[model samples]
Target: MIIMPQLSPIDVLKRSNAAWLIRDQWRNILEDAYELVFAGINPYTQDKKAPRSMNRQFDSTATASTVRLANRILNEMTPPFDNWADIKAGALLEMTMDKEQIAALDQQLSGVSKLVNILVNSPTAVSARSAAILDTLISGMGVILGIENPEDDVVPITDQAVSQSEVAIEVNARGEIGGIYRKRKIKVREIKDIWPDAVIPSDLLAKLNEKKDPEIEVLEVTYEGGPGSNVAWYYEVLMCAKGQDPHRMVERTYDVSPWTVFRWMVIPGMPYGPGPVLLGLADIRTANKVVEMILQQAAIAMAGMYLVRDDGVLNPDNIRIAAGGMIPVQYTGGNGGASMVPLGTNREFDLGQLILDQLRTAIKKHLYDGTLPPETGSPRSATEWIQRIKDLNQDLGVGIGMMMADVVQYVRRRVEVLIKRGMVPKISVDQLTTKVEINSPLARAQKLSKVQDVINWLQMANAAAPNAVATVANLEKIVAWISSMMGVPPELLYSEEEKKKIQQNIAAITAAQAQQANAPAPSQAS
Candidate 1:
């Protein structure tokens, strides 16, 4: 069992204020930004019980375009782990170890991998929330948390989406996350479920169980340096439970794990991070509105030919219009009738469409639509496809690296929690110190680039002096290097027995060649 220190209500409030203040400051901007991305409206100023109105009658092109970009990005850059089943596939990660340590390392890693699979495969896994948060992130920014005990499921893979408005983060100069304060309104029932065995007053439990529109409270979890002084990381979590005034519930203290907040890109001068899609958001929104407005105006302009009456009896208000129908009207005075006249025979729509296309092109360029794969048909050849993929990757290379880093850190934290909870074998805990290698396509492409350079050099060397190159270089070592860089599993490489036999054969061949060279003069005498 774990123990946490109890905190007075005032102390809880104090600890929460710092985070709350930061959140309040960014909420207005982030809230609106996220709304624009997901809900297609600006909800920053939405009041209680007031119906929110759309600022512009635009469709979800921004949201759809963002989704398309994210899909392409993820597709081009595969996740390091193929799936939960292959978490220990060995293709994605690297570790330094001797022959003797290999078995132990694999065993330890198996446990950790299984635990990760369990966490990631759960109903509320990161994969489930990734699309939503990713869309929000691209639009402006978004936040996601890998909570240990979400209380919604039994398997404990609790990934939750934190509204951008509720999170405040601080990053160091090196871009490492220094601290994070995430405040959310969790229901009382959820709190009870999360801390199932906590010592809560019976009366409070009774009220909570009644479920009469359960009260929600601000549950703030903060992570910063300090606390467990010698440990690698330490953090604190304080909860202000409903009805527990003046004395808040101390969820935990000195959490030995790191924070699970994932930030896509850090804002230049801001204390928190920013989104990739936010850079061109103003242009996108403007173009979307412009298109919508143009469509509406064109429809109004082309409604039909207007009938003008000199008697003023057949005005727009008195006219009853129907598609493919003729209307009958009686003239009130002699020589008074309606004449069908076109609304705007001179009004042109081609210019409006041109402007619309130009605006869309701006949005497409910023969102990287042109660089991504086309919606229909394949590239002419595999080479062409590869080149296109490489181009797309290069476009977002830095951003991809940032995402990979965050994913590694997030997985590390989850593995640590599993180890602490005894879900994984104790032996595997030491392996957590190893660096995680991202095996995503972009990362693989980088490695492939270096390998290709080496191959090219080898070809050039062979062309210059094939015999000398072959004799001077260790072919086995070269093959091993190339195979390793190509992401071949270590288990699939040549066994020790095969390697020994190959080395012996090479030695025999070299000896025979030397003897033949020495005795060549006698054979040439004939």
Candidate 2:
């Protein structure tokens, strides 16, 4: 019994008109930018006669750099937690039912988290025909849609299930993404497949069924909400191929809850997805062509140095362009002069190299503007390496912070959806505030510094009082704190009872050894 407001014909047309107006404005620019990234085409130089070799070379660098940065984020950051709900609720705050409940729930949540991670990393997680959504995410803004990927109907249900996100869909925009509209096509069959029970007019369904090739279309549009709303409205509008007026098929007033759509932006605060490689693409393409031109000029200068006498034949083709080749140039009637003249100079080549370097620097500079660090120089020691990582953290801090929020939100929404879909069993989560901790090399180094401070304090305390460290009643607590700071798994740690048992066994063994040492003369007396 899901109830939704039915839009009148005029109202539907109005909404559809608004959505298209927004789309019509932004589609070209966004599409062009996206094509530049995914297709490796410099739209400015995408003419049919453009050199394929040059395009490939430029694309390789751009794609490689983008992928490298994306991989760095994936590898360095702490993996998203599946038990974020429990962690968020401060489940360990109490020593009674709270702790027990949280502990029990963690066991279940751990398995769920692992399964989710598997699906995220697996090929099935990405959209069909997409090599990776992350590639587009880093290079440009990319969208990932969570749609039901139904399998065979007769399979037994299990927790080890695939993710629902079918593809990393790309959205096209016009100008700046801010106030503009965004739209993508959804096939009629795709809609039916994902939402079989969705409400639709009976006549439309019958018409669709009767047509051999139904050309029904649904436009999923996201646009700025009405005046003063400060939010984007998402809508699915029925767009028949015939001249029928567009009508709302489904509508959401704000951010799609539980996130059926996840948007990843390379740059924050801007609706338009700006990318690193894209910014310097024009320069890179031009530089590539310039280098080719320079080489061609140099070849002409060297090969064109032929001994041509004034009395020789003037047919240039008859003269084989090779080493030790004789050329029959036009014959001069009077005094014949043979001299060597180079068409191009080595000085120009020197200038060309400088120009090439500058172009490369431009490309590197764009990539290094927070997304990645430029290869300035190599660190000499482990300490230097740590310092370098810290520098990178500082450089990328703001961008990572923005990206972290979106990423965490995406994962959180996916987890919730998984639970609702019964792929993960629902666990009782209290008032927990879970946070995504980045365990990147830089972040880890910072954590280690904090842990070292704790160690330094403990050492001073032990020096002040002998056995002070060992005498602490809550030494295990300190150890646990340090272990957590170091990102050690909670399951790897020993419980308080287990620690007590271990201490008791050690004490008993020590006492038995001492007793035996003291009683050595007893056997001799007997």
Over 273-389, each residue of candidate 1 has an lDDT whose tens digit, in order, gives 556557666776676667776766666565643434445444555455432222334442345444544343235667767777886777767667676556477536644554666
TM-score of each: 0.74, 0.63
RMSD of each: 6.6, 8.3
Candidate 2 residues 291-365, lDDT tens each? 677766666666554555534345556666544344544542345554333322333578777887777677655
lDDT at residue 423 of model 2 (Cα atoms): 73
Candidate 2 vs. true structure, TM-score: 0.63
Tell me the number of clashing residue pairs for each predicted model: 0, 20
